[model samples]
Target chain A: MQKNIAQGNLIPFVSVQQMVALIDSLGVEAFMTELAGYIEEDFKQWSLFDKSPRFASHSEVGVIELMPTSNGKAFSFKYVNGHPGNTRHGLQTVTAFGVLADVDTGYPVLLSEMTLLTALRTAATSALMAKYLAPEGADTMAMIGNGSQSEFQALAFKAMLGIRSLRLYDIEPAASRKLQRNLQDRGFDIVVCDSAQAAVEGARIITTCTADKRNATILTEQMVGSGVYINAIGGDCPGKTELDPLLLHRARVFVEYEPQTRIEGEIQQLAADFPVTEMWRVISGQADGRRAQDELLVFDGVGFAVEDFSALRYVYEKLSDNQGYDKLDMIADPDDPRDLFGMYLRLAPSRKGEAA
Target chain B: MQKNIAQGNLIPFVSVQQMVALIDSLGVEAFMTELAGYIEEDFKQWSLFDKSPRFASHSEVGVIELMPTSNGKAFSFKYVNGHPGNTRHGLQTVTAFGVLADVDTGYPVLLSEMTLLTALRTAATSALMAKYLAPEGADTMAMIGNGSQSEFQALAFKAMLGIRSLRLYDIEPAASRKLQRNLQDRGFDIVVCDSAQAAVEGARIITTCTADKRNATILTEQMVGSGVYINAIGGDCPGKTELDPLLLHRARVFVEYEPQTRIEGEIQQLAADFPVTEMWRVISGQADGRRAQDELLVFDGVGFAVEDFSALRYVYEKLSDNQGYDKLDMIADPDDPRDLFGMYLRLAPSRKGEAA
Candidate 1:
């Protein structure tokens, strides 16, 4: 349903159905590549952003967070929840939505369901970082924990870096089969492995994205070979770490935002004073990324808000050509801002018999 | 404009149009009075809540904030912006919307436009405080700053306190005239005064709700009488206050939450060690509200998140009988949860030609 444009209260909203349509219409591969470009561009200009760590409300089972950031011209925030047990009840472990607003007027311009968009952006960001930090001429990736995000990661790497090979592993074998089936005709040389070690064999890049809330060692130091790039994504909050501490000790770490990664990333397992480089510096040619040929590197990603800001910005731009969005009468634009009460009073007679 | 409910992905949304209709259908006075009951009840059980100071991002002309709270059962947050310059552009000075989610599942149950609801709840909270702190038989209220929130405050005081007389004043005479026109035939003896002092001449309760973003003293120490309840509503954020420092020093201050009020309320002008009482204690009969008939009292309302939570709760309950809402297809409720990618892939065929 659409609201009157003249009212100037309409906010364009992209729903899950519309998001899926948007992704399919653009095609997953092309969309991820374009999203990666936007992510890289935002990273290059990261100094212009007003960045802050996400504000989280932790519960016994999970957490819900508000991640907000802006670049003076536009403001965006993502409302996301992480409930690892949600998948057990036939729900996604992570579900999200975001809003993009005009910073000048403090008014929201776009609201979009970010569950699918988050998955796309997460993979796009990982690949964008890999483009700079990954091993030279890397053509194969080992995806450990083949859950909901596995397919997107596989496709993003393929689209962005021409990586046409995937070795998949999951604690639950059914999850591995699901990932394999989803990527069947997507032009990838796929292999289903029995263990994380087996998945990492003959692969130059290892991506770990488990859903466990505890500090579990999905990848040990011995399993991670040198000259490889590790995309550690699962250990996002405190008490959640995917890679062993010894592995991080031997690797040169890169992070999206240092302050947040120290608390919410795999680096949380290390000392507070542990060294890490911000990826924006490398992207902007302000710092060196990879020094040695066989030096191990880790991208400790906790999903920063700027990436979501870029994703929302991309969706807002796409609205001009996309029909998969609806207008929401979200803001109250009264004829006279002070006569807000009168707006209701005048509508009282017409709506008198409508209330049940 | 409602979506199919059987999908289990629908989130009920009440827009500004629907919210106005809902308030008018419920009858404004009755709605405000009932909302006050909810606010009082929530205050009585305040210890059961998880409260936090609002996280605000301030800009040159405005501030955007996310206020979140939970009761271990239901979680809610409000996305609101305060831009004093917005009125010049024909927009609301303060605009808002909120979401209510299940604590266990972390799924949003309802999303509603909160510009009108905020006006209603703020007035309800003020009136609730006045009911506890005002002198006995206080019928006349001097409403200084007759803006968007002024009429609601007047109506709420009339409904809750049986105050049948109102003396209104504003810097802009047109705003006072608008308020007077809106409140005519509402069973009140309305008097539009020329200045703030003339408005508060014989009133026992003085409400100052101006929208200036600076520390402008709307009420001076000399203008206030010895025994009067001050409803200070406008000076919420830092560098923005409506009352003179001497006035706060003379009045016994009461706050919704002490820590938050110390930074955002008029009390921000005073020393950090200044004593203030939380209103819940008075509502719970744990502390005295108004000490003496001749003693001054101030309800420094910064507008906490719990009131928004209560307002959202009220709207959620009313959704059962109200059709003035739409279902938002927000959550991506995949059947297997892990097959989120497959769900989108299947829709690809149907959305073949939709991409431009």
Candidate 2:
């Protein structure tokens, strides 16, 4: 699906299949390191982005969201959904796509499938959070959700934090086996644990990426050790939280965006006055990240638009080498500012012939 | 092209080409009538929507906006841009596209080009406003901007309001001539006037649908009479207004959403405390629209997301037989929730061979 139909214009799209291929080709470890770099670059000059809370529609069955962001030059938006019961019908619980457009022209430069990219970015964000929030010299992580995003999370920790070992646990044994098997040829060692307790027994960093979409305590207050960073990814919507309120009180919580976190992140379980820090401040060296080892920390990871912008940019850069057409004629070209009628003149005979 | 490859799924996107075809197929008059009906139905049940002011990013060249709305079940968002200078580069000055998605599943149900739809909906909105603002038996309209959208506006007035006569004016004679050419077969009594004053001479309804993204006063206080129903569609973004401040003071200004219109509509030039009524209130029969034949009324329409929702619904019904697809495998579907690794095995081997 690559075309170089136009000389100066190339609208490269990363489809779900292409994204999967990109991730599988590079392996998850390399993808995370590169993605984290992109995120870090954007976060350093974070104020330049026109950031707004995602517009969401919540129905009883699931939730749909639109997250958009712009840095004076380009605009990007992601369309995503979270339906927990989708797997029963052979559909993934969450699926997504996004668009990146030129701010000057408002023309979409890229349209990408973000389903796989979402997993990559989430893992990358977790690794970035661990760089600051996790205990010094953290080498191993307990992965609570050994499902769709488990592999990416495992490799991110391995590449970024030198986490040579992964203790994986899922509600279903097959999930743990699948994750353990995927890492068979990969460099990292994987341990299939029977329970959450077994997974976290000796792990320095605990990453809870479960998919229940409900308020469930995957990690109890006692199971958490001193200085461990918790990357809570699943409990992102209202009424969906992974940590016990007590655990949040003990840990210094960090969020992607505060307003969204208040409603969608694990912080939703806590009160309005719950103290939290934005991740960008820590990355930019403006705020205190970790005071001392053994201080509990939490990256209440509710995905943000900035992460999507980073992913769109990464995919656009990658696809440029392969080349794809601006095959999608997404806009009308009015030759004269006031003359839309002129556009129709050329369409007449040619279109009728094509239609026949 | 309308795709019907699949039996049940309809994929009749209003692509730039299809939009041009849509106009050419039914002519602009019929398009506007149906568009007005769509706008009216959504406005009638205004309480069902979760409405917010459009999210916008203004760069030096133009402004890009995302307008999102939902009615608990389905959510829709339109990505539109108003780059007034884009036409010089063989692109539309105002181009757009939007999507309708299931709120629960987050799957996009429709992705349609809105460049032509924007023209349709804007005209429909004006016609809808005329329904409430115009005095009974009003039949003549003065179309001030004879540009891209001028035909749609002209046709909407003719179809929706029984407006059979038009006094047309534009700085460029060619634009006015073009409008007359496309509209000749529709049988409206059209008079191409030399000036804006000449255009408004005896018309009962005055429409200013200009294209300039500046504060150009296309309509002044001296031109408009007491009883004229004014459709102010051009003055949408900040610094882009068509009506003079004096004319706004004299007229019973009506708006789609007062808070939004105050910032983006003709009312932007008026005082903060200026008296105005939301057109929805009038549609809901809660407010008095026209006090007498001599009372002035202005419908300030800056496009809304609900209208896009209505358009999506209308297009779905119109092209229920069309079908097309790109089977995006973005989400990981594991037979068992925990067996996500199996998907990697299934996808990777096949993909790598293809990559090689």
Candidate 3:
């Protein structure tokens, strides 16, 4: 049955089960570490990429966005939705899927469930940015809002930045416990804090990933100490923001894409002209990262298309030797390109027994 | 093995083979006729839909676009690519796939190969518009550029408007012969014309569905008679257009979406302020279609997201009783919505034997 599908029509599709199996095979931390490297490589040559602000369709409940980018060689886009109320109905607050296509032919080569991949890439990007912007010798991270992404963030930081200690806090203690339980045997010294204020006690790095659609300051001005690197992940849409504006004023903000970050990042609260460095420039050594030891730094990550592109590209390259992909008959490939109608006719029940 | 997968994780994926099978089972003309009804229903309630111009990424050779729209309940988007030069390499000039998601949950419910679906919907849309725009008792269609979409247009017009006579012409004589051969036994009088002039000689409806990426004058101003309804389908991207500008000036132009058609349709040659009636308005009876017998009508179809939405919705509804769809594990659904990490950990080799 599979042999009947032409080569051009078959796209490698990685399902959620396959993604889990693949991640388990490689180990989540190692997968993210490699994914981070792909991201860094792309960021180094970011000038070659075609970057556009994500196209978002907003509704009363949520927003669905399509983030597309290309580096002339490959094109990738992620279909993601953010509905904060989804968790209440036993659904994920955010779920995603993406496609990687060949730029030469505009043919999709891979389709993968990005719900898992998005978490991995977001964490990878946070850690990759921390490598440049975090205070030197940072060994502890204060993770606010320990939800689905907490363990991934913790592991990514551990893998990329050698952070062994974590202070976790969430509005619901069960969420923090869930994070702590998930990371318990993962070789980390964990502390479950009662409040956001208590979570940041001695940690040099602070990661806020609260999922609220409105502007609620997860970290205020007084909570953020000097020289502490803040990775703000959840304030990712128009009305959603995490850091206090004053905190943004005190910190040197870095973002994946300026135009997108201006609208979707924590810096959305700030002015249009508020100074922010594009992370690609810093990764490429064209700009500064951490200017001073006591300089407050914020990696305002709303998630960019390039990071997803990198993740998809990483998976596509790995699938050559990986066991977690299925060939999907997605593209229509008629023997005669102009004879699609003839191809349709040949698929009829009467014509099915005849040779092509 | 299928029982192990969660229900929320599975999306109904209609592949090319599946689409072909579904179309064949229903019969292409019947399927398109039903699809045309869906298109008309949506067009009637056009104000309820969220319409945005397609997000396109252009390469040197072609363009890849994402067309997204919603009607408050269901959201749909089509990922389509147009590479005119692809046929030279034995690939379709256009290939597409689309997804239909629930607006309330922001979870995808259907993923379908839209190369076949797109052809169907484009033809359906053309025919639907002609039902309103075409002259009374119009039976014959002069199909210039008899490529992949020619037979579809012919059958759709036949299914919807009783158009049984097709006058076909292509730059390549082989393409015209291929079209004629396919539709020969399908109960149509098909004329394989040598030139564009000969094709449109006496027909009341002139359909141009070429695959060039440039502004080609497939139909000159003098060739289009005063009483003809022109269905122009080829000029769908920036710098790609069909029909002479003077002919557009002479005709009362109707478009799928005015904003898109201004940039991509034959009207791209005209000023941005050039008058064109929105097809939805005509469908909804807010505007007149054919005011007089001799007044020229042009359905400047650049294709819109709503039409794809209608097609996807039609398929999704039909799949309830249809046999040609596979349950694909495309979305990640953890037992606990906030325990995605735990889900990943549980998938490990050590935890394989453990029961949930």
Candidate 4:
């Protein structure tokens, strides 16, 4: 039987292929740059957002979390999972999808694959923080882990902060080689270092993103120089950290949301009352970013819902022309709202046969 | 450019059309009867599931909520919204979609439209409760507020408890007429009544399901008779209720989840320490369902996540043959888990041109 669904029932869905095609039309660097602009705009209006820590379900091997946020007019949420052991089974360590809905009508307007969007938004957030905290004219970065996020980090910095020199290190040499090969033609001076210390020798910005589900000090106190910016992104869950406790004492930490960062970011190793600055305050000019050239600034990044919200909003705005999305009939709409049963009756096989 | 995504990246999606087709093939009454079986199976093992109050974001006009539950091996969450004023705009007051994921790998395996599924599950849950609490050989039911859920409730009772007669009433007369017309060919002896009091006369079961976002009582203490089962399903949010305080005190209440029911169910009108039995205990025989023929039993159901979990599990199991689903490329997968950038680079327009 043929059925015609109402327009309100169709949700715009962006699949992985459509996401790739959209990014291809707009170069990756430009997309991140544009996405960063959206993040910045939302951060400027930070106080308007309703923020809460993600609801996470932990298992023996992994975690599934729902991060939700809204700004009175619109609501957005991301469903994400992190499983460090998934790579052994040929699966991504992180996978995500998100939805943007109108708060007034309580209807979802857009749905998109957020695995790639998460990577892009994470990198954009890192670069946005570095824009305020990094030293003057810093052009070199030390990437301590070369995994799924390494190339995005490099390109975002290049697009936002003009960082063109890189030093990379990973536990697996193949990972670093993979990163080099991916960025070979992206216009950068690259060096593959054997150790984290060697990677940070002359760089003014150091980014640590490792994939172990344990506490590992990839950067020690002595390895971090004065006046350098530290972007820590991989220590996102409890008991999963990447910085030395001593290093946190030396740096002035800034976080996306303090309540969440205290439990999931690098600062999870520190005391509950450890003082930190919220990045929104910095972006809104309520707090200082870098006080002195010799001062250390650490952006304790654990990823936040607002960043995903910004990414979802960006994709939703870009979907106006309907070029990068498919219409998904995901809602049940009857001619009369109270007649859902009548609608179903019309679709019944016996009813269809009778109508024929 | 053509890219081959791994099997793990594709999630099986059941759209509204597919859901209708699946129900048509199975027949609605049989479908709900089988779904009630699944709900019973899960309720029997209720202690093993992770239960949490739904996360709600309330606005002036509506509310959006996320209800999540898991049983160690699998996880499920439903995104639903409620807007009482949506009908005036030709929209459903309730719309939902859900996800089922494998906890072992933290990957979603199934996504389905849950608007229709929610109606079916709610009806199944009510009828499942009636199987234990309704007076013996109860064949007649009084259905108050014949909205989207009225026909489903009638059919589920017919399928599960052999209730062949229904007395329906609604403030909007058109709603009752619509429900009667929908179930006219389904072998039900239905009477569309003008008043709730008149509808409950001579009925052994009374079901109250209205769509007002207020504390208005649809059933009074004097109207309800002893030895009857009361299924309260629509008083499902804070500050919204359907039963009078006197009526709640007169009935022995059973709830899906006590902590949640105290906040969102008909019992929300009573004191915080009001006594209630959990339905799982009743189903497992830990608590008595109906002690005497004259004892009043009320199933104060403010739909729980476990019921939705059961529905998601049911659909996931039915998708094995892939007849009622579409493959959605919603995850980003790289040949090497760490080489997501390489995967994106291959999809670059310049790279596609070069390959050509």
Alpha carbon lDDT at B112, candidate 1: 94
- DockQ value for model 3: 0.66
User: Best candidate, lDDT-wise?
Assistant: 4
Worst 10 residues of 3 chain B by lDDT: B1-10
Residue range A125-213, candidate 4, lDDT tens digits: 99999999999989999999999999999999999999999999999999999899888888999999999989999999999999877
Q: Compose the digit string of candidate 4's lDDT tens values, residues B1-356.
A: 01111158998899988888888888898989999999999999998899977888889999999999998888999999988889898888889999988888888888899999999999999999999899998899999989999989999999999999999999999888888887878899998898999999999999999987789889999998899999999898888899999998998999999999998888888999999999999899899999999988899998999999999888777664556799899999878778887777776656785521
Deviation of model 2 at B32, angstroms: 2.2
Clashing pairs in 1: none
Docking class of 1: medium
lDDT of candidate 2? 0.78
In angstroms and one decimal each, the interface RMSD of every candidate reads 3.3, 3.9, 1.7, 1.9
* Per-prediction TM-score: 0.94, 0.89, 0.94, 0.96
What fraction of the reference structure's interface contacts does model 1 contain? 0.65
**Of the pair 1 and 2, which is ahead by TM-score?**
1
Q: Is candidate 2 or candidate 4 better by DockQ?
A: 4
lDDT of each: 0.86, 0.78, 0.88, 0.89
Error of 4 at B191 (Å): 1.9
Best by TM-score: 4
Ranked by DockQ from best down, the candidates are 4, 3, 1, 2
TM-score of 3: 0.94
Q: Where is model 4 more than 4 Å wrong at Cα? A: A1-6, A353-356, B1-6, B353-356
Query: Candidate 2 falls in which docking quality class?
Result: acceptable
